[model samples]
Target: MLATLDEQAQAFREDVLAGLSAPIPAVPARWLYDRRGSELFDDITRLPAYYPTRTETGLLNEVMPDIAARIPRGAAVVEFGAGSQTKTPILLRAIAPAAYVPVDISGDYLNDSAAELQASFPGLEVLPVVADFVRSFNLPEGIDSLPKLGFFPGSTIGNFVPRSGTDLLRHFRALLGTGALLLIGMDRVKPIERLLAAYDDPAGVTAEFNLNLLERINRELDGDIPLDAFRHEARWNDILSRIEMHLVASRDVEFSVAGRHFRFSAGSSIHTENSHKYGPRGARLMLLAGGWTPIAEWTDPNDDFAVILAEAQPNRFAP
Candidate 1:
């Protein structure tokens, strides 16, 4: 269900407190999506160094004909983290679903995108839900009558840890029900130099994006973070097979949020995000663990990215 305003605020407060108290202080990446942060992310996607966006888009272009054939006409297309809805038009045009549900944590952006999409596709019913897709929420009216097909593009699943990713997939499985379809993008492991460069671009756009989180905290939570005291850093961990983003303190510093204060020693950092790259075997194993049966997969020519088409696994017992 959608969290109440107070509930959402309280959850944010608790998350901040917990993250600050951890040995490796960190904040949830979702908090980084205030209006400005969302805009910066949209910019990040267009950067020439960012391969996931264009590669995934290319995969969709090549495979949508087959992908659309599997999704029944008039099915409801529900997209998670529907930022800017850039890759959505491809699916919408190809599948021509009865309705479209776009879910995102950024309410304002979500609404704006929904409005633009509705204007572009007059006949398509566009419903934008402003709740975080990670939690349980009510589906839109009339969605229950149609076959639900989930579109989770942009490899956002990489943001979560493995367990959380599995939980999210299970949530989707339950929401979509048996026989529903899921089209998800997964980024593959690539060269460390390439991965690091993607997050730490020369333009400093990503640096601004990372630092903006502090600005957001300062604005919203009455925080007093010295933005200049910290710098954005992205590193690829060979052992973990993920790229990690951190806000490294340039010097000793202290900050407060909602009247509560926290401290950071020189060289200490707040881990912000992780993008885990998966190989084909790992991806399929993840799907099976989450109760999805892999149907087929598509990839770009270089195999740097993938779009997997999977169906909700059928109930094992007899109907």
Candidate 2:
């Protein structure tokens, strides 16, 4: 069994304490993918204002055939952050891979999705790997002969800065080995109003999603933090070409953790996440930087989002 919250996990918690207890509070977005946070994210995606999930799904439905065509027959498909495996069926129907691997940091949920998928596609093999694909990812050692296709269907790539995104893509390519195919979803830059609307939905679910990150910390770390002490704030950073999410302090306060006290000035904020919006040019540049060469791209009818197919470098696989 995979160790959950082991030594690395303990160190990660300590780092979170240090960052949050700083003169300014900052929490890494990585911590937000825990079970509670994962459920909150599912709720967030269902909100009317959150458009990435729906938009990306629509585009994928429109282009699954092309995605499948790019892959050779009887390929092995692996997905990262395979939530509910909801958006994957679109690709599965077209590609019908020899094996399906779904990897995610959420162990229970990943297994649940894998079980359901196994029932749905009995003929196809299903292997579920429980680990954070962001940190360090190593695929199975065998299967060198199967066509390895990486499917990152959601706009999850937007969570990383451009440089980090490049590194992540390179890591994914390296894991897949040479002659592998990648299907990635990317959110496009749109009107500022639209971008703002998607994050700050009318139902307030998005707000809860942002603040829940704090609650998640308090719950997991034995930290005493009044959830009301922090408020959710989302802003468009035009200069950075990204949407920044922060947990703003409601009042000047001092929080203690790891035997150390950290103070936050009222009105100051802890940066939690940044969602980068990319155009076609930016997307292609990012893929290239990550060492994956783009082979095909499909955009929404209105060109609101894009799903690009990139190939791992012929020799970049981790041998």
Candidate 3:
């Protein structure tokens, strides 16, 4: 069942409070997707600097025929995040899933996207579930008997650290059940310059997208944060092999969120998000650790991105 707005808000409030109190202040990237944040993100994808969306979309179009051949007809496709209007349609057209379950935390955006997608695919079942896909949630009834095909695109998996990402994949494996198939996108480890450009776009749309999280906290959680006091900064953490987004305080500043006060010194930052790129072996190893055996993979000529197809094989004892 979808969480009530109050419940969702409370969760957001709790996360913010706890995150701020942590030794290394940071917030989860998922909270960055409130309605306005989602819209900003949609804009970010269109920017010239952001290459993942365009690269992945073109690759999906090219590989759908091969993907379709392997996926059984009438299987239900449960997309982990909000279904992309551009990309989801391509998959729906190719595989013709009997049902498409889009699970996202942004309730309004999820419903709006689901409605538009349902319009496009009149015969398909569109079940929109508003819940954190990272945590447990019940899939809408009636797709239980259908063969399951999990669609996780856009390399959102990169947002989590490797350990969390593996756990998330395992969660998907358990939720989708044994014998289900997963089509996932993984961003490749690319040039540091390209990675920085993608996250720290010249156009500043990425800046706005990053700043919007603070705006969301203020609007939703009674936070009195001075938006101007903080600026968006993106850095490539070489040791971690990830791009980290941080909101740095321009000067010593103090803020109150939900009646709790917090202070930051000049240059202190709240680490907001991470995007971890992967090599071929690392991606496959992570999937295997999460209980999926990769069967096929496709990549662009430049090797900028990848789309991998894996299946949940039955558990067996192996040395």
Candidate 4:
């Protein structure tokens, strides 16, 4: 179930306060999805340097037939972070699942997207649940009767740190249960130039997307952030094999969020997001540790991205 508007606002206030209070200040990337942020991200995906979205979409187009074959017909398809549901129709048309459950943090956006999808694909049962798929939640009514297939595409898993990533995979394993299937998209390790370009596009769409977080803070949490005081910065962390996104202070500035004030030095930055890249072997190992066994994986021609299908393994610890 979705949290009430007040509850959601309170949680947002608490998270922003806590993150800004940290030794190295940081905010959760999930907070970057207010209406404006979401729209900015959609623009970011279309930028020439943003390869992940296009590459993943192409790979999905190529592999959906095979993926659909593996997914049992009449099964319940539950998708995490189903923004736009753009590539989803490929799988839906191929598999013809009994029902579609899309879980996203933005309730309003989810409803609009779900309504459009339902209209586009008449007769497919569309059940939209607004929640953070990273955490736990109950599946809607009638879902238990059908076999469950979890769809977590778009490499959103890359957002989490390693331990959290494993925990998220395990959470999906538990939710889907033994023998259930999971189809996921992961960005693969690539050259630093390519990785940096993907996040820091030349057209500045990505920069706008990153800076909009502050705008969201200002609008939603009654923040006094000066939007132009900070600039977007993206760097490839070779050691971590991830692209990190930050909002660096262009000049020394002070801001207040939810009545709590904070200061930043000229060179200081607030970390906003991390996009981890993975090799097939590394991804498989991570899935194995999370009680999932790899089934089939496909990659684009340049080896820039991958779509993996894995099955939930029996949980020995289950009572």
Candidate 5:
């Protein structure tokens, strides 16, 4: 079941208060997707520098027939994040699932997307669950009996650190139950220039997207963060194999959120997000660690991204 609006507000307050107070101040990436943030992100996906969406979509279009053939008909497709109108339609047409369950924290966007999707496929069932996909949430009641095809696309998995990523994959495994299948997209480690451009686009939309988080904080949690006091930064963390997004304090600045005050020195930053790129071996290994076995994989011509099909197989003892 979804939390009440009040409950969600409280969670936001608590998370922001605690996160800002921590030694290394950082907010969870999931909080970056309020309605305005979501809209900004939709714009980000279309920018010329943003290759993941286009690359993944084209790859999915090319391989989805094979993907559909491997799965049984009438399976329920449970998308971890809100369904993308652009990408979800492609998969839906190819798989022709009996039902589609899109779970997301943004209820309004979810419903709008769901309604549009339902119109596109009137015969199929479109169920939108309003909850954070990072946490455990029950799928709609009737779909439990159907085979689940977990659709986690757009390299959203990259948002979490490796350990958290593994835990999240295991959470998906448990939620989908044994024998369920997962089709996930993962971005590859590419040239630093390309990666940097993808995250920190020249057009400044990405900056708006990052700063909007602070705007959201001010709007929802009664924060007084000076938006201009910080700037958006995307850096490649070579040691960690991820792109880190940070909001750096341009000068010493103090802000209050939920009646709690916080200060940051010039050059200090609050890490807002991470996008971990994975090599083939690393991706497969991470899946195995998360209780899923990679069954098949597809990639674009440039090899900038991958869409992998994995299954929650039965556990076996190993020497």
Candidate 6:
């Protein structure tokens, strides 16, 4: 395995470099989860205004043992985008995985979580893989003997567009192997006002979280994107059942990168993130199409989000 920058990864970076000059303010959503972006997201979750993290964490806390019961014995527990692993120990404690694989790109952050989890769990082996989870992963060779159980909480599944979401889940299912399990957390559709409030919080952590994309570009690509020149915007699209986050340009500007100058219209906008809010029926249908059998699902009393367990479906998705 190339181990990093799979074919898709190579193409995506090329697309972004080309798209940067196409008269629009645009960046792919994957770039927003780098170390700094990850830190900001952790901070965002801690903000009182951010309810999804706390509420979903609470629901998972109550239901994890039952969730663990669904796992086949001696299963390896794997988590994608396993940042600080804030919610991991709960499941790990309950199921007590033979191995815990936390996949993340931030080495420092990933190692810290791995050390803490390994130290606390005593017998469980904590494997920290420091690579972008959006790219394909090579599960460490050590745990191949055990069955796999995939855990992805924090409602991070909502970050993808519908098609991309299903595709990634399919890839995830294949990686986990036959009869493998998938645990997914999703934000469900609700009153538009409530959805809007969650993203556009009073404390502005969400704003920082959204705008961190610019900072990532500035820091990594060596691009000069004046943070103050862009405005963070969030809106609820009732029709699509999604909350769209965007960065709007304050005025016309030109940027140069890799010896290329890209121009943006004065009022242009770059789409940052899309958090798909689904109804229960819709979520189940999506999972079914993606070849996962929705075994158990739970929702908070307020009806804001859902955490679901699904088993791998047949090979490919047609529906």
Predicted structure with the largest lDDT when compared to the true one = 3
Model 6 quality (TM-score): 0.91
RMSD vs true structure, all candidates: 1.9, 2.3, 1.6, 1.5, 1.6, 2.4
Question: Which pairs clash in the backbone of model 6?
Answer: 25-270, 252-266
Instruction: Write down the TM-score of every candidate.
Output: 0.97, 0.93, 0.98, 0.96, 0.97, 0.91
Model 2 ranges off by over 4 Å: 1-4, 21-25, 315-319
Candidate 2's residue-wise lDDT over 1-319, tens digit each? 3336584468468768777766756666776777767777888878777888888887777777777777888888889886455688878878888888888876766777788888888887888887778766566545567888888877889989988888888888777876788888899998989889888887877778888777766666666667788888889999989998888889987775545666777888988888999999999999888878898888988888899998887544322
lDDT of 5 by residue, 108-225 (tens): 9888989999999999999899998887678998998999999999999999998999889888888898899999999999999999999999899999999999999999998999
What C-alpha lDDT does candidate 5 achieve relative to the native structure? 0.92
Instruction: Tell me the tens digit of each residue's lDDT in model 4 across 1-319.
Output: 5666686778778888898889998998888887678778888888888888888998888888788888887999999885455688888888998999998878888888889899988999999988877777878988897999998888998998877888888998998889889998999998888888889888888899899889888988899999889999998888998999999999999989988889998989999999999998888888888788889999999898989999898886322
> Model 1: clashing residue pairs?
1-136
TM-score of 1: 0.97
Comparing 4 with 5 on TM-score, the higher-scoring candidate is 5
The lDDT, on a scale of 0 to 1, for candidate 2 is 0.79
The runs of at least 3 residues in candidate 1 whose Cα sits more than 4 Å from the true structure, single-residue gaps closed, are: 314-319
Q: Report the lDDT tens digits of candidate 1 across residue range 1-319.
A: 7756676667777877788789989999888887799889999999999889988988898898999888898999989985345689989989998999998877788888898899989999998888878888888878898999999998898988878888888888888888999999999999989999999999999999999988977887788889999999998988888999999999999888888888999999999998999999998888887888889999898999999988898644101
Each model's lDDT: 0.87, 0.79, 0.93, 0.86, 0.92, 0.77
Model 3 ranges off by over 4 Å: 315-319
For model 3, what is the C-alpha lDDT against the true structure?
0.93
How many backbone clashes can be found in candidate 4? 0
